[model samples]
Target: MATDQEPVLGIDLGTTNSACAVVRDGRASVVRRGDDRIIPSVVAAMSDGRWLVGTRAKKRRSVDPVNVIYSSKRLIGRRFGSAEVQEMRQRVPYRIVEGKNEAIMIEAGGKVVSAVEVAAHVLTYLRQMAEEALGRRVRRSVIAVPANFTDSQRSATRIAARLAGLDVIRVINEPTAAALAYGYIEDTDRVIAVYDFGGGTFDVTILQITRNVFEVLATSGEMFLGGDDIDEAILGLMVGAFEQQHGISLRDNPVALERLRAVAEQVKIQLSSQSGAAVHVEEVLPGQRSDLDFSLREADLRPYVDPIVRRTIPVCQDALRCAGLSPHQVDEIVLVGGTTRLPHVRSIVEETFGKKPQTSINPMSVVAVGAAIQGAALMGSLVPMADGGVSAPSAAASAVLLDVVPRSLGVHTLGGYVDFIIERNSAIPLEQTRFFTTTTDNQRFVRIQVCQGEDEVFENNLKLGELVLSGLRDAPRGEVTVAVTFEINADGLLEVRAMDKETGQQQVATMRVLGGLDDQEIEQMATRMASAGPGPSSRGGTVVSR
Candidate 1:
């Protein structure tokens, strides 16, 4: 369906697996690599100094436990000292070291690589696969992210796309994208709830769709919860069973643990379709002569997983409350992410909504399909459907999306109180300005301590970064008024600008995101990637060129 023009791709850069899709002839479908539609988001460093991506990389995890790096999504755009990164370091087999600017880095392939770089490799593989499937060059794309992603995380995702040589036209939220895929072409206007429980993160979003406009009323979720937790629960059960059988704990052995993790994931999938699954491992323990076999019934695993699935209920209820709507007010409940395939997950969702959730679309590919529709709509290439709505709209007509900021943004004052600039759930692509003056007489500069949270106490919130507005006129405390502007862009990334009221001059301030790479570092990595070209074994014998 693509002509000479380069096609735009919609990529779901997920934690457990990633996918891509495109729009053709007013319909959206997923792009596949040979017979495979989902690619594992794993990367491995070969002994020959080459990198392996996707399935090949995932296979190397058990063999080269120290070199294969998966779940880099959890580390991307995270501070080295943050609680999340510290937790990840303890769980993963690869080594995580602090890099410049306190960014999280991993030791792989005899080199120190930032989480951004590792993620870039996965993005590159997806880009190549899309191009090959379309039989044309693919550059522009719309990438999806969690609804609760912070400014640094959003910025880091954009940078990763750039490193992969893709021009990201927009970064849409995952739940919003799912809604678009589900109701974009429906003729009726209604309120829909999107429950996106993915591999690495979970997000619940409430949206009101009217004609061609989709407005996100409220969004909330746990950044650390998802299908990964289910896998972890099963892994723990296996670990206990193995230890009891062999009288030895395999937790200390990274290689054996990795092997068991793979089996646990498979069993988790099998249990979804069947009442029980048999998990068998041969030579699982060190120097073991016998095999370990165990029967895992759906009922036995439900105790561990049901509690985790129930955790999502409060988040969903909170989101509905934020939207000022009750559960019955919601017309349709759409499920997204692979974890939604679980029978218990669906049952709980139905009970919560008093309605059956829609699962006609493949949960794993819905987000990407929705993103492709958005991309096509943005590019003015979508053709209007025969119905009142559009399966795909023309270039002259595009749907309007109104998103909101997930958290409140403010600055720390002299009294250690937060001066709220932008409130949470405020419609995004918004700008607000507030004026502040120095507290001390003849103060030469003022410090702006930016933070993100609802806490009134400055220290209780997460510190985003700081800015020092210098070269101010040495006037009385209240006389030197400065106007500070806080802007949340369409992609939900924050930007601040300060100006002197009297001189009308923009103040020079340092804007450093706490867990993000600096311009210089990004540029250096771009240069290195360009010079190195594609890794020798990156494609697992599938030819890829720079």
Candidate 2:
């Protein structure tokens, strides 16, 4: 346990921006780097062999497009050979090359780095900012991730936090964290649906809150969906219009595309509040031969934005159906993520749920605030406040969080069939065991192929890893039996173990999951970062470059 004075920070490490907050005395407030709470999740490679994070890094996107890496979250925990990675390679300006163990590596600032390393840089910046704001050495934290994030993604997130030198106390789902922030202020029990639409991903979660206890009933999402898609759609429109007008294709120019992406993002945000927005770019093409200037009305943009927003409706419906509830039964619909600020998104949410959504809290900071409250409760330092936020540590100390596994867990059985050990939506901090015997006579080892998904074919789902139980006594077929156990902790991390019931010998096979760095890689990167010293230091008070 930490002293009350040494507070634990809560971090919302987002796809586009990140924020941190803390619970002190009896109140919970977001930690500010001066007056700014949201920090862009961007990193740039500098000519001096150092790195630039946040606003500074985002600024270099136009000038050093090839070396500036943004939206690394989409690449984290993904295989280099995956279709998503190939698509990302085409979308971003930076060079993404395949690395060891099918990992995705980025070529930036004349050096090759992993997605985990890039994410670590952003986390380190946030950690430093929090320490400076609190005037204390911040060590422990609770980080939030998308509710439907895979096992590899979760593991990679933990590794990133470790590299940032923060002890991750827990990793909570973003939707669940939002619900916590909303429900912490009140004592009533209710069923709520959390719609978290962020810059790079969309997630819908249905949870039943009984006092302080939050139990997730169902969760569903599309990892490739979010605000970025809308931006890309708008960019597509601009490119087509520009090519038609200028008779030149700007698709091959990385720098120009980067600039256009920035512009497209701005236009999207502008259209949210106004009826129309002007899109203009001077010297958009090389040799100063081409430029673009156009006017886009909200009605024009709706054709692109509407389809993207509507895709979330089915996902929300699926989650509700899985939870055995209807929209009318939900007590509240909480809108989270910066993308929720769009009027069209808000209107669609209301239309889907038949109730007005709650947006009283800053959607960007709500997850971090809830995480901070959870951290304080875990530390036994939380105190009641008059602001209708979380109550005292004594009252919160009894609060329990019951989460669920987002996907199914299974093993490959005879004939390429999937034998599910634990079904999706099963409560967390749970364990289930199944027995297996050798298919052939005199077998000495059993190979266990573990996976996550709802697919019936063993190879169709995401392969988490494999475990091998050896040293088994050679015997006739079906003579030897081993018990394999799959356990998911409260934080939603999975671990597997195998035991030979006949010999009482157990072996825990290493799970070679993707999306995170191994111990050796992490240690080497940490040492390199330490020897390289820190990047250019900028106080949090700086204006947002976006």
Candidate 3:
């Protein structure tokens, strides 16, 4: 058990599964429930108006597909009109409807629920399990997210943590956390590449690790690519085979397709360690007694998996090129995520790195353990683990971590173009101030449109929101000057501030975010959750607030 007077927990909020860990007496360990170390990241609504999380909830995916929400991570913080959400609506058995401000809402349990609430329930469950295992009150945590998660996504995650009654002290990228978990413990100073292939996302990060400082050199990833896509590929094979064998298609039958989806996931897992796996489903057709039986060989499966695995190679190359290193230049490579267990995937990684990647550690829980180390470090108790691996004892005792902004932040300028304030890969907890002039005479306030991306064209970048800076002195065009400052914290959350250049007065910054909940909405939801006294209930936030 950890010896900290008040232990801080590190949580890996993964798409397929989640885990929590803590560092005690300088050794970081995962907080498990008996043998149930990993919790399925699924939530379901029972008929009695109660809720179920983890394994029980995941089991409901096929039985009560509509009431069960799996892969909600892919939908959270995304707009309803987005290509990803629209594609998901047609793919999943559950209903995804457009709520107020185009936010994605899930229709489950005969009522509508926001994606934030679904995530809160999952976070709540993770917190409860941590408290139970540690035998203490756990009020603070460090949550790990993907490297490329947007500002809105990060904000949504923090709100979820608050609703779960845990204060998120810090938010670190998954690959960065994994690197930390590996670096400070080993005491090695070298360049490393972290290939994180998770349930819903794929990312590659190159880092330069010093004795106690870790700096992210370059990072690139696909927002919607990973194990889920692999499952879909395998699922496609099963559907095609079943349709060919029984002369019936299961694609139109959602319930039947749901059953097949479960089988598809199981087959993928089974094939991970074996050369072949059998797929058997009884009564796979609607109102028809038809058994679908088939066996998939590793060689045969590779052809289907080839395309998905190939997509990651270019992404790796891109990161390496950006980092100004060759494939053979990196000192070491580490793989993170459950999806990395596939044999072919490992072989591809081996081919890329010119050596077999490290596999001794549990990829699923490694990120959480690393996060726990960071949590301990933040509390000023972290040091080299009891095993005694890291060197530079003095520097290791007080480690420092540095991260970079994933994408560029800018504002929409005249002629529908972008004027970048902070470029991509710039260090975080950073701020840049640029002065702007009024476009029209006697303009009392100027509306500054904030966006995120690298494109020079306004329409090409993502419009985060607009910040209104008021109380300006009236002046002629291009006369009154306003200084706008863009700040991104360590967690990559963006905040803007404006000031009058002439008088040096701080002006009010009113931001109207595009999709996710604002401060007031999140506060209201948190209050409701508190009143309910919380045992896995849902909350909803439909409107956008300023």
Candidate 4:
């Protein structure tokens, strides 16, 4: 058992909102600053050398669209030329470009910055708020990530935290975090499904809890679909209405469209709380306010957002089938994500699983709270395990987190087939080694392509990173036994190394990140921070507070 005095902080870094909490006296409570349980995950850089976050940063969106940053979570861990990146360009307001080493870049105030820096700015703000609330340096935390995030994506997230001055003890999958937050701590034997539909992403996970062990059976998700998609769908409806009413297409006008989109999002949120809300847009056309008296009954709103909800059904079926179970076998269903708050979401989920979904815990804050619980466990404040899986009697202890490979770990073979070394669902904090020979005579280099996903074809999977071993002496094609080891740490990210077995010589190596920041990009971000005036403390405006 850990000492009772220290607390473990749990953080939920979300696409639309972020929250933090700490476990004290065996009770978990969200750490609140003011009356907000959720701080809008928005950021703004003022011209006067100040930075603003949360509600204040959100205020700048209408007037200063060029300076405000929202929906940045989509860019993290993605390449500048990826399909997602191409789609984001047409959807979001900011400029998306290729930075050094194929890293995604965003332009603001005449400076180019990497996606990680933007994420760090938001995290740093959260850290400061938590430290101020706790009145001490909050050094340890358990952060949550989407269940389907890849190795490079997870690594980029950790790097963002490092830049934000946080020491993340571990990264828990969002659904698992929600399960922990829901008090799945008893030695109850049951299978539970977590339906996570957040702002920008959706994930469904099936877990089996036995003897206090939470084993995730299967996971599936759609990266581009979430509550945000619902908002976009409604925005399209609003735009169509405007175009029909007025002979002008608002889509061609960026500023007006951004404003209307923001309002459309608010209307969608309002529908969740109120049975009917008047959807109103300001000055959609100069001197003409676009006014549509919109009254949405629970029955009416269902059709518009139902398609979005329906997308999750197949994913759920896939997860259950992968776990070798039927819907009848699942004992409990839990909902996680802000979008789940919508009444239709629960009804559809219950109807699908034939069980009342657990709603005692707030979906939005569950992940963060669970992260704190895990954080406390890892900090030796909740459990006695060490960071490296040892035990300690006091504060020197750490918790052992045994995560699984969410997807198979593999390398590209000669004919484009993926050879799996350690398959998916294998116990983590583990290592796998493989040996190979040079393909051609006097081959001075051996190339390794690391990939994630289940597809046999290389193009169908997610290419995470690559490693190349060079400096081999002139020899026959099969002369050298190049031993390569791929190790996945507790964070579920990969690191690779290669060596010559015969000569015991370490080959020159480099991890070719499929979509990662390079030294040049990192330096440019540093310079941009110096030149872009002071960061705003918080942006200065308020919408009807969520």
Candidate 5:
């Protein structure tokens, strides 16, 4: 082992919960805070203006349903116009509004809060929990992001951590983090796939590992899919039951609907460990004391969620196709995420992959544990970096994180067409160069719109950023040659720049990122949330609301 000195923490911030682990004495251990390894990823504002996180915030949901913010992860780094935002608005009980600077805002306790600020509160809480568990002033950490998160999403996550006062050491993909955690157990030599189905994201990745060399062959995912979708299905069932019993629709009441959804989530968790679970719906209206309890069997639950589970199959097949492998060719299938705990989810994987997935490791903690291992390796405290700096920790100054461009990267071309430069799954920490020319004769400047996605039309794909190469001497169209380079680093975030290679002059252009909320806007909203505090008559029975 090479002697590198420093220590860092690893955090997996999830939609419903957050987990932290640290590498100590050559092993990774889940760091507990107040008797909980998995802290509820909810933040509530109390009447006194203090923020309550984790379990306390979760309890406050029953009383102060309006002020508690859960699952804000879906809104982070997203624009108001995105499909995910549109769908979330219809499904989630919380109010999401377009705020200043196009930031996504959540209405809580009579105050409108930005999604980033809510996330910052969660991050701040996790950081303190880790610090308390580790008994040190933790500053740097490794965070795990979904394999399919876009540039804006990753940037948003980084900003949230920065606001929380922690130095983000690195952002590793979730699948890769799980692979690192597995690789530490036994220096495995084979190709492995990490199938992650979380609360709000689904990612299937193929990785090759041999002699400390870990390479990601392919990755594919749907950002809107996950365990929460399954919960919604069960919630729909509860709604039907309530309608039949009371001869009234609960869906019309947002407060009652939100409470039912929360209880449905708990029932889903219980069903995973037991065969039958009962959910009691108390009188949701004023001066009501009657309760409606319904018991659901596992078989009854399977069909309701089969379609959602089936959606993951095609995504898995697509990932395998991208990796140029059939299901039989994969040596091992590793499961990640809390959703994988469901029996039906496991059965579907077994039927599709033709192999039993390894669940010896807790799917929920694997990502965070793996992240801690990588964090320790990065700090040079556990594993040593390699000399060539091209492979694992034993070989490089920077831990070689070979990430892939999840979607195609391109620039808008003539007639509204998009020309592709880098295809999806291209190894990261990678650089690709493409040449462009002035579209108009005697043009002194060229505008290039950088985009991500596989569509041929510019409008169909995501507009990531833009660049304009100016001050070029007037020349015939197609005469002035400009070289554009797209560089994606280990964190899977993009950086694009242009140069007149012929003149060796750098291009001075600003990038207009579509659907991104800036730091100033996020901070301003956070300040407002802090000042407004929580509302009265919203607290009761160990439930604290802010």
Candidate 6:
């Protein structure tokens, strides 16, 4: 068990990369090993039962396409048969399989590994990195996730942290964490928008900052829009050029596609600094004496990627509308995530917010720094940092975070419609209850269909699972009134409780979240990971330059 005396680490477990930070003596700084501040969220298996993580693992993608797993975050906490997973299947070279409860499992390293387990590998590597940098053992941490993450995704992230041997003290939204990192909390009230564009997801959040209180007013996002999509666009051009030259399509070749994907990412990164990037792939056609070469300038890429960048505009408009604010009302715009480094992306953000984005703090590490501030705040050691941030804060501390639910939570009702119990954007740690009566005479039980969405028709909304209220008092129809309460805690995890209205006694109430690992399975994977081997090769490897 971790005690309050232990230092808490703040982690940004991202889709393409991961970073960690901590607060010491009122200053929060991102922890780094030498010049490396962030590690690639990739893992690979060696033939000797050893696992390679981070940059080394990322480099293995071209040679070991099926065994090297990246972008697992998109599938984490998702069903294997979901549209998103199915869509991802077409892009990546790895194998996606269905696990128990339809949870997504990736076949890598000659064995099937759950997304949670793969994420745990990244978390474990991050933990080791933090411990090495801080020169101490830390077990408590605050994690940041995307604003659009559902109950299952958040739960799966927590389990990953548990497997990493760290106790999760809190989970904050990425955009919210970025806002805190900018130290936007001043005496006067101001509205700020966080445009977080990363490798595998994009999110836009509008928040109102008053003194030390950060309240999220509205948020909108797309899970599949980011740098990866841009890479895909570049890959498309490469595939077309290859087909034109060699009269062959590399689209169906996993190895060729993986190799092209790597070069495409490198080209994207290179074009950010240079006028044009030269992409060359040697021996692209198996053992043949063949090469695929190309050159791309920013202007050439703008056509293919501008559409992807513009997709975020409507999402921003939606968030601002939901927040009851206009573009002019926003006092400042803060950019977070690696994808924000692109000039085109920056230009788009400026056009949307009518202001230059904040660039003093590193976009890649800001969220982690803010999360560390929150962790220190929770431990009661928080102070206003030198940069744009307050320490990790406790709920009871002077610095408070007012987060909201991303979607509407409701129950199935008459006419197969949805009865929204808690509307979207409502503040957290709040509870709402609705009374239910039996429909049949001598009814002993009632099953409440719990869902999350704003659809008027029940079937159109997402089915989270059901809450059963049994052992009811046998009475005539409508005589027995059962009070069902839905409570969303600070973590945004749903909890249901039922009570007998007549007897004033608590009854059975449990919510079964779909497309996630159960408690026992989480424990089993944790144990298995413990014995998996020494995680993250200590041998030095090249770190990608951002």
lDDT of each: 0.83, 0.82, 0.81, 0.77, 0.77, 0.84
Expressed as tens digits, the lDDT of each residue in 1-546 for candidate 1 is 233445569999888789999987667889997888888899888777667889889989889888999889888887899988999889888999999888988998787888998888888888888877877778999999877677788889999999989999989988778888875545578898999888878889898876644667788888689888898899999888888888888889878887888898888888878999997789896576746787799888888999999999999999999899999999999898888988889998998889999998989999898888888777764534466554444432255676778789999986999999999878879999999888888898988889898899999888888878888888878899999899999888898888998889899766778878888999987876665565433244632322
lDDT of 4 at 293: 38
lDDT of 3: 0.81
Instruction: Residues 167-200, candidate 2: write the lDDT tens digits.
Output: 9999988877887776553478889899989888
What local lDDT does model 4 show for residue 101? Answer: 73
Q: Estimate each model's TM-score.
A: 0.87, 0.85, 0.87, 0.85, 0.82, 0.86
Error of 6 at 13 (Å): 1.4
Taking the tens digit of each residue's C-alpha lDDT, what string does model 3 give over 1-546?
Answer: 234657779999888889889987777899887798888889887765656888888888877878888788888777778787888888678899987777788877776778888888888888878887878889989999877777878888888888988999899888778877775434677888898888877889998766644667788988678888888888899989988898887788767776787788788888888999986788786567788997898889998998898889999999999889998888878889888988999999888878788776788898998888788777763435667643333333366676778889989888999989998877778999999888999998889898887789987777787889887887888888889888998888998898888888898888877778776768777764565354542222111111
Better model by TM-score, 3 or 4?
3
lDDT of each residue in 1-546, candidate 6, tens digit only: 123356789999999999999988667899888898988999886655567788889989888777888888888877677788999899788898888888888877667779998898899888888888877788999999887787778888988889878899899988778888877665778998999898888889888877655677888888778998999999999899888889898878978887888888888888876778987788897799679888888888888989999999999999999899989999989988888878899999999888998988888899999899888777774444667576554332346777778889999988999999999878888999999999999998899898888789998877787788889988999999999889999999888899999999899886666777888888788777877655663533321110
Separately for all candidates shown, the number of backbone clashes (residues 3 or more apart, or on different chains) is 3, 3, 0, 16, 13, 13
Q: For all the candidates, what are their Cα RMSDs to the real structure?
A: 4.2, 4.9, 5.0, 5.0, 5.2, 5.2
Stretches of candidate 4 off by over 4 Å are: 1-7, 45-51, 210-213, 232-267, 274-296, 381-401, 440-442, 519-546
Write the residue-wise lDDT of candidate 5 on 351-432 in tens digits: 8899999888889899899888888777763442366443343432234444567778898988999998888777777889
In model 2, the worst 10-residue window by lDDT is 537-546
- Report the Cα lDDT for residue 98, model 3: 88
**Clashes, model 4:** 16
Judging by lDDT, tell me the better candidate of 2 and 6: 6
**Candidate 6 structure, TM-score to reference:** 0.86
Name the TM-score of candidate 3. Answer: 0.87
